[model samples]
Structures are given as structure tokens and as C-alpha cells.
Target chain A: MKDNNRLLSRMFKYKECYLLVAPFYIIFSIFVIAPIAIAIFFGFTDFNMLEPPEFIGLSNYLTLFFEDDVFLVAVRNTLIFAVITGPVSYFSCLLFAWLINELPRGLRSVMTFVFYAPSMSGMLYVIWAYIFSGDMYGLLNQILMSFGFVKDPVQWLTNTETMLGCIIIVQIWMSLGTSFLAFIAGLQNVDRSLYEAGAVDGIRNRIQELVYITLPSMGPQLLFSAVMQISAAFSVSSVCMTLAGFPSTDNAALTVATHAYDFGMIRFEMGYACAVTTVLFIAMMAVNKWIQKIISKYADV
Target chain B: MKFKRSKTGPARSTAGDTAVFMILIIVGLFMLLPFVYAIIQSLKPTEEIFAYPPKFFVRNPTFDNYKTLSQLVDSLWIPFGRYFINSAVVTVVGTGANLLFSSMAAFAFAKYNFPGNKWMFSLVVAALLFSGTVTALPQYIIMSGLGLINTLYSLIIPAAATPLGLFLMKNFMVQIPDTVIEAATIDGAGILKIYYRVCMPLVKPAALTLVIFSFQGLWNSTGGSYIYEEAWKLLPTVLNDVASAGIARVGSASAASVLMMLPPCALFIFTQSRIVETMAFSGIKG
Candidate 1:
């Protein structure tokens, strides 16, 4: 009887502890988990919300694999985009963070504002759309023309090649602040004593110190942000749609998410869209898992 | 190695200072050029807005565009001022809800002894991968059933339960010392009082960080028609329309774009000092 009571009391304590964090789980399961499952199911069958789902299994996958041109286009486009922006964005953010950190205390915050202003504005698309407009009047074209580069004006967004470049450029601009701030935070956490130790051990300079120590120390945050960039690069849209125009002049700027939206909402090909979205989902998750494993080895956060 | 080790240094900053100065100048010019272009466009006459070799500087600046936009106050369903107020109300109320509820939930997870907490918190953290788009279709249906489809609650409610904010707060709260809570308990404080009087102050810096990110997200976001309006209007959506048909709508589009971007830019300037301080507090400082 005494043993039973002790076990019951310990159980009660753990239960109380569990109760503390219950709200997050309960809400997450309903909104996040349930919907994603529904999206998966929606992909496997013909369920258009208004209509009953008629189970159609592998057909969606088959068609997506072989027949659909846009699916392939989107996949190709998204991978190319991730390849283009991921490393460049990562380095720039770290560089910006390093610069911001070295600034005197009072001015650092204000300077970061200028760096992050485009992102904080929420109207990045608004400003950039005008600058990259196809007309000769566009700021960039005006610059090119004044420099005697083009006779009339080079179309920036309407073309096949440049539209993707345009989207990537704008994305890089908006992305720097969050990752940069996080990098700065991570750098601050590294003990200055370590640097002193390195110096005493005859480390030559800041460059060597940063490469051997600061970079390794900043690894966890860097990994998280890098992995996040991969996923974000895959899921990119809205700006492409708004800035470059959906069904872009040459279908050049069709990203994975835009394709999903186009097929899912605009075309109402629910099952097919789901299959495509599932591919994106799987690809993202695969990278996420790989990166998570990598981060697991390093990240304390 | 090159410079002899002097015990008393002559402020070895000048060399580093030059490098820092050059970096700042390059980055500064890169960021400033686009904004300066926007300002120039906003100030110029309509015809010149499309003139070849776009004007880097406005010859005759005018508020005529701003005046006209301000007067579009009577445009049928909503006006410029009304839209601005609506946006502010939703953003402020939504941010408040996020700060309160997420902090409460975070505190509970951080400090309290509760059952199923570990698996539950893990579940919450993992849910970060699901983007807003994936949740949209069903959430709309849920809101429809709740009779919130046309109300600001659609915007406010969903915006309040941000996974990112909750995650950020929880991460920060984990750093809060357990000793403070133990002292509070010794004082015979109730859970609610302990939370309000003790833990909340400790969490303020993190809370403030979330506030900036949350406002940035909520304000800058171009919410779909399903949330913001029965018609679903936000400045970005309006700007999208203007850009698509920009050949004829250049004046309105340019003015509208300027207005849309200016508030957040100004607000960013205002909170910039706070961002630095928050960075320092969160140990993201220099």
C-alpha cells in the first residue's frame, strides 16, 4: 500500500509537468498536423472540397511523373533557385552580421535598420517591381541606357532568362536581416576567452581565428538558417507571382509553390496539385531531416 | 606578426576602421540607391515617372500625388485613412494577443511541472515546418463555421497563434534562471501571480523581440482576401493590381506603392534602437 502511494504521487507530478506544455501540442495537432494529413489525402484522390473524394491513387503520381510539363518546370526552377541563392545568401548574412557586430554599440542598431529596411518594409515587391519593370522608364533600364548599353531597353522580367534572376535578386535582398541577426546573436554567445586562448596559442589574425573558431562556434545557428533557406527557397512564391507575373512570359519564373497554387487553386486539379505539393513536401522534409541530423551533432539550441 | 608586439598599443583601430568604413560605404550605397529612387519617383510629376533615362533626382517636387491619394478618402467602400486604421488595429491587437498567449504558454512549458509536456513541446517545435499556405484551406473552413469569415477576427485570431513567435519566446525563456522562480514559490505566490509579477518581467526582452518580428510579419504581409476583407484588400494586393495594369495606372500605382512602404520603413527606424537593445539582451549583441 505504501509503495503504491509513492508511485501514484510520482505519476501525479509528471502529469502536472505535462499539463504545463499541453496548450502548444493541442493547438498544433489540430491546425498543423491535421491539415497536412488532409493535404496528403487530398493529393491521393479527387477531392475538391465541394465534391466527395473519389480515390484515384497512383494516377496523380504517374501523371505528375511523366505527363505534366509544369511539374518538371517547377521542380527544375526551384532546385536551380535554391542552388543560386542559398550559399550566396548565407555568406552575405554572415558577412553582414560580422560587420554589424564590429560596429560601435550606439550606431550598430541604426545601421542594421538600413540593412534590414527592405525586409521590414513588406513592400519589397512594390518597390522592386517598379525598378525592374519592362519599360525603358524602369530605373535599372534607365541606368543601362544612360551608360549606352542598350539601344532602347532590355526587357528584364518578360524574358525567359532574366525573370528568374530578378526573383532571386529580390529574395536575397529581403532575406539578409533575419539570418544576419541570428548570426550576430550566435557570435555574441561565443566566449571571448576562447579568442584570447587562440591568440596566446599563436593564432595569426582575425581571419584565421574566424575560420577556425568563430565559424565552428557559429555552426548551429548557421545550420538552422541554412536548412531553413533550402526549404524557403523551395517554397518560394507570391513575389514571383506578383513581381514577374504568374505563367511568367516564358514560364521561366514558375517556382514549386506557384505551380502548386496554380494547379491547386487556379486550375482546381486538386489531386494532381497535391501530388506535386507532396513532392515538394517530401523533398523539403528529406533535406530538413538530413540537416536536422547535422544540426543534432552541433546545435545546442 | 608583422607589427612588433608593443605592450602599450596606439589604438590599433585605424586599420580595421578603414576596412569597416569601406564595407559600410558599399553596403550603404547598395541599400540607399533603391530607396532614393523610390523617394525620387514619389516626388516627381506623373509624366516624368515614365520618362526615358529615369530621373535620379526630381526637378520639381510636389505633394500633388500624396494630396490626390489622401483625397481618395471617398472611394466607395473604403478610404485610405480607413484602410490605414484597419491595418493598425488588426496589427496592434494581433501582436498583443501573441505576446500574452504565447508567453503564457511558453512560461507554463518553461517553468511548470505538467504532464505530457516533453512530447507536447516537441510536437509544437516540429510543427514549424508547416507553412501558412498549407493551413489556409481548412482554416478558412473553420473560420467560416465560427462565423468569423468576414470579420477582423479572421486576421487577428490566426495571426495571434504564430508558431514562430511561440518558438522564439520558448527558446529565450529556457535561458531564464530557475532560482528566481524558486524564490517566488518561497514567497507563497500563486501560479498566476508568480507568472504576472515575476516571470513576465524576465521574459520582457524576448517578448519585445517577438513584438518586432510579429509586427513586421503582420503588417508587411499581404493577407489574402479570405482574411482581411470580404473583398480581400491589402496594400500588396492593391499594388499587385496596379503593377499588372501599370501602363495606364502609373500615377495611382506609384503613389500607392510609396504609401504602402513608408509606414513600415518609418516604424523600422523608430524601433531600430530597440532592436539593438533587444539583441544585446538576448545576447545577440556586439
Candidate 2:
């Protein structure tokens, strides 16, 4: 009670500051926080859109784990997708940004555009659909045929064998987005004098300089990029849905987000979807925490 | 500080420079191929688009696909312009409100040592892990509760409070020298005055970066679950309908995508440098 009084008094002292932040917190609570709370609450219930939620403790989770084969496939696919794309995308963003940072300003901007444009153009990723389209008219098929690589037009999107691979390619294509930009800026902000000092300290190669100076200086950006890439990799759905149909060829490209989307939107199984999403939320937070620890450890070194 | 193009210590050998250039060019071309293909496809005549042994270059380019798109738009149940208007209102209002609110909140977090400041900022950061897909269903419930369902506000309100804007703005604002704020306070300026008159100007690059991000996001938004009314649908939703019609509408689909891409690309081109500038201060060290 005494602590509460002190806190309240402190808040009153910073009343103007509270007023400034109130709008964001209010809207954030209503939209983000409240919904998350409600979703967790509704996760236990078996609510269709029409009826009020019926409280059923742990049954939904039991069904999800024991009965749902499709959900299991989704979890498997999501893990695979995140594992491959997360590190690949993060490193590539760093590498490309570093390379681009070496160019003359005019060429640098153009290259940045070339890399960043795919991610920015909303739904333009469908162009990849055209390129990888399953017909003779598809660009890849045509090229392959002409080059005598394959006589048959490969069904890239429809084939279960190749569907996930195609989605990964497109995901990487779009992944050099916010993180890439942040890295370039971070590289720019790195103190150049450190490099000259490192040279004097017998840092002979560019790689050595990068390790001793650039990486440490970019500690924050690296962390930010890792978080962005990890979260994005985990929540891969819309691109999967667009390129390959939802519930694509034997659910080959199914992911956690798409699974939630399937139950929530298509099937109207609101409670099941909430449960799926809640699990996803927990998984993402866990991975985020782990990655943060690793990155901060490396940064400190 | 001006950004110098080259490092002084290591004189890069020509062989190394050539290797770097070669790799950059190859990767750059790979990154650019789909976009180039889309533009070419959009321009190709009907026969060229579906030609056997599909060619990389268009033999005869035409505006016919764009014409077809315009006709398709005109034939929609609601006026085609209504979707554009809806998108514009959502983007402008959403972006404006988000910038204002986020910057205000950012100012408090950065400048004031208020109680709960660290806790509140951490909450904002934590919210980043919750993707839109996870929250869509619950957001719909909240929207329906507030009677914002089927309204543009359903899209706008949620977007206006996104965590990215607040995150970016606060990071940028933290870089401003504390003495500047002290000077403003000494001049009898209030908190609001210092925020707008002093701090906002200093963070223009960050504000511009936020504007670009917010604008692009809101502009591309399809008003997913919360909006059901055809009249309230954004442009992308309507254009997506046109694009998904079938193989017959392929030309129009490519044209629709190119049209969708133009505004954001144009905006990025103009402000690319400013975005890079703003991102310099965006690092989040623990």
C-alpha cells in the first residue's frame, strides 16, 4: 500500500508525461494487449463466431496435440522454414548491406533499390508465381526447356517436393527489407577511426577488421535484425498462400500462421485458432528471448 | 558527419574490387529479375505474353493490358475511384495519427525519467513478437465490439498504434542532445512546445522514415477480417480480385501489380537517403 502510494505520487508528478503517452498506451491496450488477453482467455473455450465462448479447460489443447495431424505437419513445416530462413536471411541482409555500403553513392542507392524493391511492392511477390508458373509459358519452365535441362515443364508450385523450396526462395527475396536498411545505416555509423587503429594494432585483413571493429560496433543493429528476421521467418504465411494455394499440395507449404488462418478464417473454428495462435505467440517469445541472449553475449565479447 | 565512400587504411586491390563487383552484379540481377519480368509481362501484347517458348523480351509492347485493367475497374459494382479514395483516406489519416501519437509517446520515453518509463517501453518492444496473424482474430472481436467493423476506422485505428513507429521514433529521439531540451525548458517552453518546436524538427529524418513505413503499410493494407463491405474495401483488395480472375486476366494482373508498386517505389526513391539516415540511430542495444 505504501509503495502504491509512492508510485501514484510519482505518476502525478509526471502528469504531463503520462498525458503524452496515454494515447498510445490506450490504443495499444485496446487493440494489442486486450486482444492478446482475450485470445488467451478464449483459447480454453470452444467458441464458434456465433455462440458465446464455452469454457472447457485444456480440451482444445488436448485435441490440438493428440488428434490434429494437420497441425503437427504445420508445426514441423514452420520449424523447418524458420530454421533455414532465419539465419540465411539475417546473414544475407548483413552481407548485402555491407557490400552495398562499399559502393559509390549513386550505385549504392540503385543496388539498395534493386534489393529492397521486392519487399516493398505489396503483393508484387506474385510475379514470382508467374516466373515459377507450372506451364510451358512460365519463364523458368521455358528457360529450362530451351537450355535442354528438362523436357517437361516442372510443376514448381503444385509439386509437394518443390513447393517449400520455391516459397523459401521468395521469402529470402523479400527478406532484405527493414533489417537490410538498418544494417547499412549501422555500417555508416561505425567509427572509421577504429579501423585505422585496428590496422596499427596489426589487423591485416578486412575480415579481421570486421571481426574486431565492425561487428562489435554494430551490436544493436545485429540484435534488431535478428529479432526482425526470426519473427518474420516464423510468421510465414501470406506468401505461402499466394504462391502455393492455401492447404497447398498435401499441405506441403503449411505454416503455423497459415494454420491459424485456416482455422480462424476459413473453418470458423475460432477457439482452435486462438489456441494455435497462443502457442505460436509462446514459441516466438521463447525463440526471441534465446536469440537476444546469444546476440547480447556475442556483442559483449 | 559526412559518410566517406572508401576506407583509407586498406587500399583495395583491383582483383578484390572486381570480385566484389562481380558478386554484387550477379546478386543484384537475380534480385531485380522478377521485377523486370513483371514490367515486361505487363507491357507484352496478348500473344507475346502467352507465346510458346516464353521470351524474356517483349516483341511488341502495348498499353492494351492497362486499358483492360481500367475497363475491369470501371465494370466493378462500386465505383473504381471509391477504392482509391478509401485507400487514400486510410493511408493519410492512419499515417498522420500514428506519427503524431508515436512521436508524442516517444518524446516522453526519451526525454522524461517518469515512473514506469522503462516498463512501458519494454512492453512496446515485447509487442513486436506478436505478428498480425496471431492478433487478427482478437482484433476483429475488439473491432466488432466497438462497432468499427466494416468501417475504415477498423483498419486505421489499429495501424495508428503499431509498435514499430513508437520504437523507431524513441530510438531516434534518444540521440538528441539533452541540453537542447534543457534550453527549451529555460525559455519557458512547455513540454508540448519543446516536443514540436524543438525536438520534432531535430528528428525530421526519423519522422520521414516513419512516414514512409507507415504510408507503405497502410497503403498496402487489404482491410482483412474487420472489413466486410465492398464499398469500404481498399484498392489492393479490389485490384487483387481483378488479378485473381484467371489465366485470361494474366495481362491485367501483371498491369495491376505494376500499378500497385509504383507509388511505394517512387516514395522510396525520393526518401531512400533519409531512411538510411534515420536508421543510423535505430539500434537497440540491451
Candidate 3:
């Protein structure tokens, strides 16, 4: 009885603090946590929105690996997208941010604004349709024809061979987004004195200073950007959907996200979608762990 | 190691500086091309927009598209004014709530020595890795269950408690000096009072950064799932509709796209330097 009373008092003592944080917890739990839980549960069921979910063990997973040809293609494409864009974007963000950090303040801001604008602006990328338009009038075609490099317009977004490549190009362009901003901030946050100290401590140049001092100091920002890149890389359907049609011809540009969107929202196969999501979740977790391992090496140095 | 560090900044010669400037300009133009294209296209007359050899620069620029948009606003069977109001209300209210809630939670995590605080903070961080695609279907189910479908609140309320906002706030707040809080407490002010009057004002830059982020997010979000009702639909969805209506509306669609892009661009331009400063200072200070 005495212990129970003490516990009650302890809870009461922190009630205001809990109250301050309650809104986020309440909303996040209902909106985010609850949904995630539901998704996981639905992964084990045969649910098609109209009927109650009937439990089906491992069939969805089995189908995904063994029977779903389109899913296999999606898996391949998603991996390609993730593998190519992930490191390219991460390294570019770091390099550009590092370079921009060395500039004078006003010029640095202008350059940052220019690079950052594409990612932040809404659907401004729709202009790529014109640039890559399949006609004599298209910019790329006109440029190529002007140089006599090609007599005809090459279909950029429509042709199966080039659509994924086109999307990847756009993806790389937008990839220097939030993570780039984070890197800029992270680079600025690195102690100026440390570089001087390192210079005194036999650090030769900028490269050596970066290797010895900067990476170790900005560990948190590095981790944050890695996570951002991973999430952004994995969930790249919107760009594909906008640039290439949803089920791009031959499923050439199909990402796991677009595939899941097809099943979940369009076809109302919530169970199958959840199963697909589960697979992505597992893959992403593995990739995130790998990324941490890679980045932590630099953090430690 | 023979190389020496530059005292002024990272060491560079005139040639190296010029090379750096050249690279940055090339990259900047690559980044700026789409926006530049879109803006010029939005202003171009319809003939110039789809001309045989597509002109990079607008030959005959006009406000005809904007005029067409304004006159045809009511033809879509939904008042254009309602879309504007709905977009404003949702973005402003949603962003305000997001900042307040995230900051309050962040303050609690940063300042208070409460039970389960570490676990909760870890949860927020973990939540950051989970994408919206994983939760979209279930989110729809939850929204419909709560009868929030087809309402602006559906958008506003769910987006109010994002993990990123909470993480950013917590990261910033951890750097704030505790002595000020102690002083406030000693003067008989409560946690809420200290948070509102003392800490909140101190973290205004971080808050403004959050505002820019949240406004852009909410502004660009589509109500395709939540609200199909024309009255409650936001700007992105309407802009999408205008853009997809057909080739005839493409000119006006470009104008609409430019219009949609303006507020966020303006906000970003205004807040960019401050955001950079605040973000740069937070991690190391913390």
C-alpha cells in the first residue's frame, strides 16, 4: 500500500511534464504508431477493403518472391534506384556543402539557394516534360541536332530504355535537398579552431583536415543525412509517377512504392500492399544498418 | 605533410577560386534550369509556349494566362476563392500547431527529468526512419474511422506531430541554457510560463525554420485521398487538376504552378540565412 502510494505520488509529480508532451504522443500514437501496427497486422491477412481480413500465413511473401514477376522487376528497379542514387547523392551533398562552406558568406547563400530551390519548389520539375519532349522542338533534340549528333529526337521519358535513366537524372538533381542543407549546417557547425589545431597537429591540408577533424565532429549530422537519403531513395515513386506514367511501359521505372500504391489504393488490396510494405521495411532496415556501419567508420576517425 | 592551411579560409589561389566559381555556376544553372523554364513558360503566350523550335526565352510574354485563370475560376464548379482559403487555413493552422506541439514535447524531453523520457525520444528518432508509404493505407483507415475523411482537419491534425519537427526542436532546445529556466522557476513561474515566455522566444529561429518546412509540406500536400470534396480540397490538388485538364489548359496550368510555388519560395528567401545560422549553431552547442 505504501509503495503504491509512493508510485502515485511520483506520477503526480511529473504530471505537468507529461501534460506538456501529451499532444504529440496522443496524435503520433493514433496517426503514426497505430497505422504502423495495423499495416504489420494486415501483412498477415487476406484483406481487400470490402471484406474482413482473413488470416493467410506467408502466402503474400511467397507470392512476392516466387510468383509475382512484376514485383521482382519492381524489386530490381528499386534496388537499382537505391544503389545508384543513394551514395551519389550523399557524396555530392557532402562535397558541395563542403565546397560551399569555404566560400564567402553572401555567395555561399546565393549558391545554396540556387541548389536548394529545385527540391523545395512544388512540381516545378514538370518543366522537364518540355525539355525532354519527344519532338523536333524539344530542347535536347534541338541541341543535339544543332551539333549534328543525332538526326532525330530521342524519346527521353517515354522509351523504356531511357525512362528510368531520365528519372534517375531528375532524382539526382533533387537529391541534393534536405540532406544537403543538413550537411551545410553540419560543415558550418564544425569548430573553426579545430582545423587550426589540426593544422598545427600535422594535418596537411583540407582533405586531411576533413578526414581527421570534420567528419568526427559532425557525426550526428552525418547519421541524420544518411537516414534522410535512405528514406528518400527508397520512397521515390512520386517522381517516377509524375515523370513516367504510374505503370511505366514494361515496368521499367516501377519502384516498390508505385507497386504498393497500385495494390493498396488503386486495387484495394490492402493486405498485399502491407505485405509489400513489410518487405520494403525489412530491406530498408538492413540498408540503414549497412549505412550506419559505413558512416560510423568515418565518425570514429 | 608539407601543405599548409589558409588562415583566411580553406587555402586557394586565384586560378583555384575561379575554377570553384565556374563549377558552382555550372551546377547552379543545372539546378535552376527547371524553375527558369517554368517561370518563362508561365509568362509566354500560348503560341510561343508550344512553338516548333521551342524558345528558351519568352518572345511574346503576356498576363493572358493569369487573366484566363481568373475568368475561368468558377467554371470548375468550385469557387477558386475557397481553394485559396482552404489552402491558407490548412497550411497556417497545421504549421502553427506542428511548431507548438513539437516544441512543447521537445521542451519536456530536453528540460524535464521525467520517467520514460529517453525511451520516448528514441521512439521519435526511430519514427523518423519510417516512410509515409508504409503508413498511408492505415492512416486512411484511421482517418475514415474517426470520420475525418473529406475534412481539412484530416490533413491538419495528422501532420501536426511529425517526428522531424520534434527532433529538430529537441536538438535546438537541448542547447538552451538551463539557468534561465531555473531563474524563471525561482520567480514562481511554472513550466508552461517559462516555455511560452522564455524558451519559446529564444528558439524563434528554429521555429521559423520549422514554419518554412511545415508550410511547404502542407501547401504541397494533395487531398486526393482525404478530401475529394471540391470545397475542402487544397491548392496542390486543384493545381494538379488544372495541369491535367488537357493541353489547352497547359499554359494556364504553368501559371497556376508558378503561383503555387511563390509563397514557399518567398518564405525560403526571407528565412534562408537565419535557418542556416540556427541549424549550424544547434548541433555543436548542444
Candidate 4:
């Protein structure tokens, strides 16, 4: 009888744990789940917030893909950004993480801050805004002129050709801290014996060791970085907005998110915006899956 | 014959390696060059500021920018001291709540074996897929409906339950042994008690990491539309005003940027190594 009571009580206790964590599920379901559903469903319809939902089928997607020049531009800009910043940001963080990893713990952490500070450092957008201002007083222009590198102020943020690259560079600096930290975590977790084994195998230097061991051990993190960079490039907004004002300096700096803002928020083309987002979402899913497949293939190799 | 002729046991890094290293070093320096330049420029006195060729290092520096910073701000909006306090209140309370709630949820996921647990955990992980980046529009609309636009709570409430935090805490907590939970249960403890007293202490490292990230996220938020809809009084959102004002308080914008960034910088510096190795869990597995 006593044993049965203890078993029953233990079962009740487990239920209590479930109850404790239920709040997260409740809030997450309401806030996150419902909106995503709304977005997905509304993508297939012609419903703005002000109007009742009207089924438009895939017209929104069709228009975004076929007609919207800005959507295509966002797609191109996003891809270009992902491709350019991907390897550069990844390797930079790796280098920083590796550098800090070799040092004493106290000093190592200090250096982490120096590099990571920019990640969350306030008003980076504001400062960059000043630096990239269209006017002559902009820092980049002022400096270039003072150095005789240029005779006049360049519209760095305004120019379509250079605007995207400028934004990517700023982003790489402003937001890479987290990825860098992840690399450090991975680096620390690397088993010491692997290096010792390589040394015994007569591995000549750091480069060989890095390629043969470090790269392979860090495959998961590399995958993580790839995922993050792709998503980040996809969600590009603030850096562009700050560098150029809203409407994004002739709409050249527009990404899918910016396009959504223009449509859903600014123009109130909520249904059309949802359709655009759906396209972007499908594209990202395909890309993510494709990357995963490639990784698997390479693993086999 | 030279000893070098004896063996080819392992390939040495060639000139390519040295070249790559130099290139990487240059890249790292370039990465840092702007901030260094900003520091140098921030230090220059007003008289020397417009020198024909800008000085890479200031000759005679002053605290002029920092002083002018206060007077330069529109107190009705940002209200200098209030921005710091507002940022602090939001970040602290928000981060604290995230750490506590996330860890508790992570504990249940890791230790318990209830029905639907797997599905629930997967649901939680999917939350990571939808981020602040994409959810801002819906979130803004919700915040406005709730009448929480310009308050410090604007930053805290919506952000308090981040999916990444739950994921991070769970991943870390999984590494924790099951025996600890078993032992706690044997001691006649309640689930909340175990979560609060036992699991909380064990997950301190992960909690620290969560603290670092949440603080960064909340502090980094600029001009939540809902907030600007009502009143404009936060460090980050205030930057929008400072930027739009043109030449009047251009110096103040720079100063505000510097001031706004200082805490995160300090936090980054203070938790530098830890931020990477443990707390940030930036997932360096790559």
C-alpha cells in the first residue's frame, strides 16, 4: 500500500513539472504559431488587416516572382551578401576564436569583449549612419578627401553598385560577435588528444592540423554558421535602413524583409506582403535543405 | 646530404600558409580599424576636429564630447539619465526572467519523459526558426493592441521568452547528469523546488550565457514602433531622432552612440572569453 502511494505521488510530481513549463507553450502557441499560420494562410489570399480575407490563390507569389523588380533585386542582393559575407565572416570569427583560445583565460576573455563589443554595441547604426551620410561631412568622405584618395564626397550608401557591399561590411562588423563566441566554444571543446595524436603522426604545423582535424571536428559549427549567415542575409533590414533612410535610398538596399515592411507595414499591402514572405520562406527552406544535402554528400566524401 | 633531405613524413605549410596568415591578420586589423579611428576622432578637441588632414591620434584631447553630450540631447524624449535606467531596468528584468523561465522549461524537457514531450520539444525548437528579425511586424501590432508601445516593458515582455534561450538551456542541461534529478526527487522535493534550487544552480554557466545574450538583445533594440507611437524615451530609439536632426546635434549623436554601446562593450569585455567558450555557445562546432 505504501509503495503504491509513493509511485502515484512520483507520477503526480512529474505532472507538476509539465505544468510548470506549460506557460511557455501557451504563450508561444498564441503569439508565434498563430501569426505564422496567419502569414501562410494570408499568403494565399488578398486580405489586408483592414479587410476580410479573400482567396487570391498564388497571385501574390506570381506577382512577386514574375513582376516585382524589387523582389528580384532583394533576392539578388541577399544571395550576393550571403555568398560574400559567408566565408569572410566565418573565417574571421574562427581566427579570432583561435587567437583568443591560445592565450591565458583572463586575457582571452578580455580580447573576446574587444571583438564582441561591436556585436551589441549601441548606435552602431547611428555611427555608421553618420559615417555613410550622403553629404560631405560624412566620415568616410571626409577622411578620403583629407587623404587625397578622392577629390569629392561619394554617395556610398546611395549608389546601387556599392550600397549593398557597404551594408554587408558594416553587418559583418556589427553582428558577428555571437558567431565568434560559438567558434570559441567549439574550439575549447576540441579534445586535446586529437592535436597530440596529429603531432605524433608528424603533422608539420598548424595549417595541416587545422585542415585535417580542426575543420572536421568543427563541421557542426561550420554548418551552424552557414545556417546563420543565410538567415541573417535573408533578414537584412536595419543595417540598410540606418545606412540609407527608409525607402532605402532609391530602394536599392531592399531585402525581402524590407520589401515586407514596404508592403505590409508602409503600404498596407498585407496580403501581397504575406505572399512575398511566403516566397522568401520557401526559398530559404529549399536552400537550407540543399545545403544539408551537400554537407551530407561531403561527409560521405 | 642535409638532414632536410632525409624525410617527407608530413607536408610543411608552404608560402601559401604564410600568405594566408598575413592576409587574415590584415583582415582582422581592418575589422578593428574603424572603431580605433572612431576612438581617435572622439578624443580630438573641437578646434583641431576640422584639421585639413585628420589626425590619426589626437594631440590635445578633451572630454568636450562627453560634456556636450548631455546638453545636446532633447531631455523631453531621451532624458539622459532615464535612458540608462530604462535600458538597465528592461535588460535586467528581461534577462533575469529569460534565464529563470528558460532554464525551468529546459529542465522539464531534458529530465521528464511525459507523453507529447518530444512533439513539444520539437515545437520549442521550431520557435528558433521564427526570430525577432521576421516577427517584428506581428509583434509590433500585438504590442500596440496591448497598449505597451513606449514603456520599458515594451522591450522586456515580447522578448522575455526567446526560443534560442530555451534551446541553449536545454542543450546545456542535457549534458547535466540524470542522477542529480533522481537524487533531488528522492529527497522529497517538489518539481518547482528542484528547478529553482537544484537545476538553477547547476545551469549557472548557461544562465550567464543567456544573461549576456538577452542583455545584448534588449539593449540593442532601436525604436520599437509601438514605443515611438506613444513616447520616445530609450537610449537606442533616441538614436533615430539624433540621426534625423542633421547638423544641430551631430556630435551628440556620436556621443549617444558611444554611450549606448559602452555597457555592451563592457559586458563583452568582462565576459569576453566566457562569452565565447561557454556563455555565447555561438555554436563554434564549425
DockQ measured for candidate 3? 0.43
For candidate 2, write residues A1-301 as lDDT tens digits.
9999999999888898999999998999999888877878878999887889999989999999999999999999999999999999999999898888777667777888888877777677878887899987788998888889998999999999999999999999988887887676566556556766777788866667677778877776787677778779998999999999977999999998999899888888888888998888789889988887998787731
Candidate 3 matches the true fold with a TM-score of 0.88
Tell me the TM-score of each prediction against the true structure.
0.84, 0.90, 0.88, 0.79
Error of 3 at A182 (Å): 2.2
Off by over 4 Å in 3: A1-17, A191-204, B1-7, B10-16, B74-79, B107-115, B170-206, B276-286
Per-residue CA lDDT of candidate 1, range B1-286, in tens? 1112122122224566568768976886777666666667777787777665577788888876666554453453655445556667777898888777677777777776555456666555555554445446766666677788667777777666666666666655554567877878899976667777877765554566577777777775566646546244555554455344635445555576667666666766566565455444543211
Candidate 2 per-residue lDDT, tens place, B1-286, comes to 4444353446345566567678999999998888888899999988888788788998888999999999999899999989999999999999999999999999999899999999998788777766666466677768888999999998888888878888777765765668888988999998888999988867665676677778888888888877788989999999989877988888998898889888888887877776555534442221
Tens digits of per-residue lDDT, candidate 4, A173-220, equal 865665676666555545455665787888776667777776666554
Q: List iRMS (one decimal) for every candidate.
A: 5.0, 3.8, 3.8, 6.5
TM-score, second chain, candidate 3: 0.83
Query: For candidate 2 chain B, which ten residues in a row score worst on lDDT?
Result: B277-286
Q: Candidate 4 versus the native: TM-score?
A: 0.79
Q: Rank the candidates by lDDT, best first.
A: 2, 3, 1, 4
After superposing candidate 1 on the true structure, give the runs of residues whose Cα lies further than 4 Å from its correct spot: A1-27, A185-204, A208-220, A296-299, B1-13, B74-81, B106-126, B131-134, B173-206, B221-223, B227-249, B275-286
Q: What is the TM-score of chain B in candidate 4?
A: 0.74
lDDT by residue (B1-286, candidate 3, tens digit) is 1112232544345665666678888988999999888888888898887787777899878999887776667677877888889989999899989999999999999888787898888677666656556587778889999999999989899779988788777755654667878889999998888889888766665677677778888888887589987789887787777666778777888888888888988887777777555545543322
Predict model 1's lDDT versus the native: 0.67
Better of 2 and 4 by DockQ: 2
